[model samples]
Target: MNDHDAAGPSPSPEHHPDGVPKFDRRMLESLVCPRTQQVLIYDADAQELISRAAHLAYPIRNGIPVMLVDEAREID
Candidate 1:
């Protein structure tokens, strides 16, 4: 068998080698701000889930979203 067949398919860009499932963009369709129940914008550069309506920036750590209001940082 070929090496490709033995090692299996390569991981997608959204997946990490550490076995953590990267935050799927599709999640934006379902996930909402706890404070305002508004749609969130994914900031790939900052790795944050931005809630414009709530004026808060929720951090994404290790491919997991920390959605708690207490964990979020206030923004302008």
Candidate 2:
């Protein structure tokens, strides 16, 4: 079999080469601040997911979005 067939299923959403998470509309809408349940804004320029209410921004590294609270960076 070819490599495609051997590979079976596609890669996970967190492992894209572009360093941007492949978030569907539903998923994006569902992602709220764990602490405040506030909406998040997608910052393409910064390549991060920002929660303004929480003053937190999650980074996307090598196409993988770091969603952990501890891994997020504080924004001004």
Candidate 3:
């Protein structure tokens, strides 16, 4: 087999290595703000989960979400 066949498709600007999408959308479907218990808006570019009700943005690092008030950033 050729290297191209083994490697499969090259990583796109949007995806990570090993053919895994950065942060699965389906998982976020059930994610909610810990404080307000409200739905969160996923920010793909910023890699954050925004909680409008709480006016906070939770950071997601290495495909894992950091869902902590202390770690969240206050938003306007």
Candidate 4:
């Protein structure tokens, strides 16, 4: 067995099969909703930054927040 095989693979940033890179969880701390001017909460399960006040979910594309209202999903 080779050293590389024994050491195994190292941890890398998580991403989707589509190649969308996952952003840092700490990024949530400074994000705000453009419409409501309110802080966002990271929804790791859905890969979105949710703005409860605006009732919208902004997508995290390639590890960056697409904060545009047009791109955001309206919540019920």
Cα lDDT, model 1, residue 57? 99
Q: Which consecutive 10 residues in model 4 have the weakest lDDT in total?
A: 14-23
Tell me the lDDT of model 3 at 36: 97
Q: Model 1, 4: alpha-carbon shift in Å?
A: 18
lDDT string for model 3 (1-76, tens) is: 9988999988753456554358777879889999999999999888899999999999987777889999999998
Question: Native-vs-model 2 lDDT?
Answer: 0.73
Q: Report residue 73 deviation for candidate 2 (angstroms).
A: 0.6
Alpha-carbon RMSD, candidate 3 = 5.8
Cα error, residue 72 of model 3, in Å, equals 0.4
- Estimate the TM-score for candidate 2: 0.60
User: Which segments of candidate 2 are over 4 A away from where they belong?
Assistant: 1-26
**TM-score of each model, in listed order:** 0.72, 0.60, 0.72, 0.71
- In candidate 3, which residue ranges exceed 4 Å CA deviation? 1-14, 17-21
Residue 68 deviation, candidate 4, in Å? Answer: 0.3
Worst lDDT 10-window in candidate 1: 12-21
Clashing pairs in 1: none
Better of 1 and 2 by lDDT: 1
Give lDDT tens digits, candidate 1, residues 21-71: 578888779899999999999997777999999999999887888999999
> Which RMSD does model 4 reach against the true structure?
5.3
In order, the Cα lDDT scores of the candidates are: 0.88, 0.73, 0.86, 0.88
Cα lDDT, model 4, residue 56:
98
Better of 3 and 4 by TM-score: 3
